[model samples]
Target: MPVLVFIDQSEGQVKKASLEALTYGAKLAEQLGTHAEGVLLGKVTEDPSLLGKYGVKKIHHVDHDELTHLDSQVYTKVIAEVATSMGAKLIIFSNNADGKTIAPRLSVKLKAALVTGAIALPETGDGFMVRKNVFSGKAFANISLKTDIKIIALNPNAYKIVSGEGTAEVVSFAAQIESPKVKVTQTDKITGSVPLSEAERVVSAGRGLKGPENWGMIEELAEELNAALACSRPVADTNWRPHHEHVGQTGLAIAPNLYIAIGISGAIQHLAGVNRSKVIVVINKDAEAPFFKAADYGIVGDAFEIVPKLTAAIKNKKANG
Candidate 1:
């Protein structure tokens, strides 16, 4: 059976997480001695055949106006039907908002063994065993799935996206399209800044910045680095930063390539959401701050003094280059 990957897109553009999932699915297909295929729903601006560069051999595209928006129930039914028809033993999804909603539903409908937040590829030597993050990124757990059909939701930023050269054969799939139960009247988008969830780099701060007035430096640093801006829960609760900018155990979880923390105490709750970052740079005046323990590099200095210097240095480097 071929490995089938669900390609997630937003506003006609493919999501980075979906690309990662595609690469992962392609690798898994290679491991299983099977070909990798992709299933795309909704109208996309880019050619679906371009996805073959990530390693899929073919793309089954369902282009319909009703499929533009995410309707988890409808998507589950369509994906289930596709999986059944293609005889796909393994199904891959990116563990983003869309995948989180549909993967579980499809798993229940198909009676497949489901694993979410899969950080690594499965070890198929003995049985199908996958490693995943558990307990809010605190630890890792290897789960064994004993089922004929398996479903995996690859965590965003957990797997590297590998692209080579190839063009997938695009096949238009005629699927039973259903009207979405939920209606989106309007969408308010935050523009002019990198979205924290998909950002390669992030600069976050906390109450230690003292007040909202001090946020200019943080923003300047983020601007210099071209990184997304984030804050701790207390900053958001105090209205210093918007709630959407908050990242912690109870807020948004992010695993960026580079995560820079300024004036944040690095509480366990806060760390839970960002610990998966490849590199953590903590800037705090308090030398004993808990965040330093998890940081790849620690700067023991005042944010007021250090942040400006860092921003200036980055600006100078860019200017010189």
Candidate 2:
């Protein structure tokens, strides 16, 4: 049996989270003394052959134009077909938006043991056991998968994506395609800048920045670090920043390696989204700001004064090097 990883794509391109899933699947395949493969639903612009470097021996593509847009029901049926056909003992998905929607349904359809929000690889000594987060990132629970088939939805940024010299052979998988039951009339796209979900490092601001005019400082620091920019719910609600930059419970959940929050007093809702970040740096003038309690590093200073210095330090280091 082989491990099949579902590669999530958008606008004909694969998401960064898919690479992480590929890496995880590859390593797991090696551990199981088997090989890893990938499953793609629609036509992707990039060459799937290049993805072999991440450890996928082959890529199974459905290439149905009808799959241009994601539908949970249709995609689940197709993925289950691919998995069952390949006799996939283990399957992987990025626990992002698409994975969140389809994983549960897939578990029911395939009768496979499923684990969502998995933080680590499976421990398969006695049986298949996966570790996942619980209690809103406050605790961890080890779950055992009892089915003959296992499915894991990995949390983004939890695993480092490492690629080496290799290329996956592209293969065609013939599966009956069905029209999406869901209709899409129009699409509203977010414009400009790096996407927060794809970003490895992110610098976010909040209402404490006062107004839109002062946001240049935060953006400057973000630019120096080549990081994605984000804002708290309040900033987006007030139109200080676009809704796309919002990162909180009501907005996008991100798991960047380094999350720098400036001027944001952390609310439980906000922390719920970013608590998975490997490193969190909080910068606020208030010494009692709640965000500092959860921060890996903290700076108690005015954003106006501290940000410029931080930017200069990063720039100065680059210059000296």
Candidate 3:
């Protein structure tokens, strides 16, 4: 049986997490002596065949208008059907919001052992043991799945996206469509801002900036770095930034390639969200700020003085280039 990857899309575009899932699934399939295939259900603008570069050999597309929006129940049903039809022994998903919802539901429907937040490839030498983060990114756990059909929801940014040659053969799969139980009355998009969850680099601030009026320097830094803007929970609660931009245990969790935190004293709750970042740079005047413990790089300085200089330096370098 082939390993099936769930391709998540937003606004007709495939999400970065989905690409990671595809690469992870394809590699897993190669280890298991099976082909890697992708299954997508939506009105996607990008051709699924283009995903072949990620190592997916085939793609099963169910282009239904109803699937354009997320309805967890509806998506789970369709994916379960696809898995059954294709005889997929393993299903892969990114441990994002959609995957968190649908993977459990699909596991219940298919009676498969499900593992979420997988950080590494399964250890097939002994059994199907997958490594994952636990205790809110504080520790690692190796879980064993002893079911015929297995489901893995990989953590975002946990695995590298390995792309190579070839074009995936796109196959059409007609599935029984169902009406969505939930209704999306309105959609409000944050214009011109990169989604924090999908950002490669991020610049975040906290209460130390004083107020929203002083956010220009932070924004400029983010723009210079081509990074997403984020804020600590207190900043969002105080209306210094949008709640969506908040990164903490109670807010949006991000694992960007580079996480630059300005003025924020990283509390344990806040670190729970961004500690997964590949490289963390913390800038705060207080030398004893707790965030420094987790930061790969730390600068003891005032944000008001340090941020502008950093932004200008980056701009000058780009201009020279």
Candidate 4:
């Protein structure tokens, strides 16, 4: 049976997480001695055949206006239909907002085993076991699935994306799509900043930055490193920064490649959200700050004095290169 990957898109553009899911699904298909195929519901600006670069052998596209905005019920039905038509035993999704909503519903409908927040490829030798994060990123757990149809939602940033020189054959899929009950009357997009959920590098601050007026250095450093700007819960609560930029358990959870925290005292709630980052750098004046323990690299200095130096150093390196 072939492996089916859901290609999540927004505004006619594919999300990075979806690309990661495609890479992961393609590798899984290789292991299972089968081929990986992608299914996209909405109209996309980019050619679906280009997904072959990530190892997808074929792409089934259903270009419909109704699929543009995500309607969980409608999307689930279409995906179920595609999976049935393609004889896909394994379905893969990125454990993002849409995935979390759609995977479980589809699992119930298909009578499949569902696994969310998968951190690694499954161990087929051990009855198809998958490792996942538990305890709010504080620990790990291995789950075993014993069902005919299996669905896995991969955690963002948990898998490496591998690309090759190839092009996928694009095939048109005719799904019985239905009218969406949920109508998006209007949309408000966050402008002038990177989407925190997809950012690879992030620079976040807290109360120690003192106030919103002191955010210039933090913004400059983030710009220098081409990192997304984020903040702790307190910063957002105090209106120092927009709530969308907040990163904590009570806010937006992020798992970036590099996370730099300046002036934030690492509370458990804050750590819960960002601890999954590949590398964490903490800058705090207090020597005994809790964030130092979790940081891959820690700098004991004032943000005001250290930020400018760090920005200048990065600029110099770029100039020299």
TM agreement with the true structure for every prediction: 0.98, 0.95, 0.97, 0.98
Find the candidate with the highest lDDT and give its number. Answer: 1
User: Distance from true position, residue 140, model 1, in Å?
Assistant: 0.6
- Model 3 stretches with alpha carbons more than 4 Å out: none
> How does model 2 fare in lDDT?
0.91
In model 4, the clashing pairs are none
Scored by lDDT, model 4 comes in at 0.93
What value does the lDDT take at residue 82 in candidate 1?
A: 88
Write the residue-wise lDDT of candidate 3 on 246-308 in tens digits.
998999878899999999999999999898899999999999999999999988988888999
lDDT of 4 by residue, 1-321 (tens): 999999999889998999999999999999999999999989999888998999999999999999999999999999999999989999999999889989999999999999999999999975899999987888999999999999999998888888889999999989888999989788798877778898889999999999999999999999988899999999999898999999988898888999999999999999999999999999999989999999999999988999999999999999998
Lowest summed lDDT window (length 10), candidate 4: 185-194
Full candidate order by lDDT, most accurate first: 1, 4, 3, 2
What C-alpha lDDT do the candidate models reach, one value each? 0.94, 0.91, 0.92, 0.93
lDDT of 2 by residue, 1-321 (tens): 899999998889999899999999999999999999999989899999899999999999989888888899999999999999989989999998899988889999989889999998899878889999886676799999999988999998889999999999999999888889986677666666677887889999998899999988898999999899999999999999989899988888788989999999999989977888889999999999999999999999998999999999999999998
Estimate the overall C-alpha local distance difference test score of candidate 1.
0.94
Clash-forming residue pairs, model 3: none
For model 1, the stretches where C-alpha displacement exceeds 4 angstroms are: none
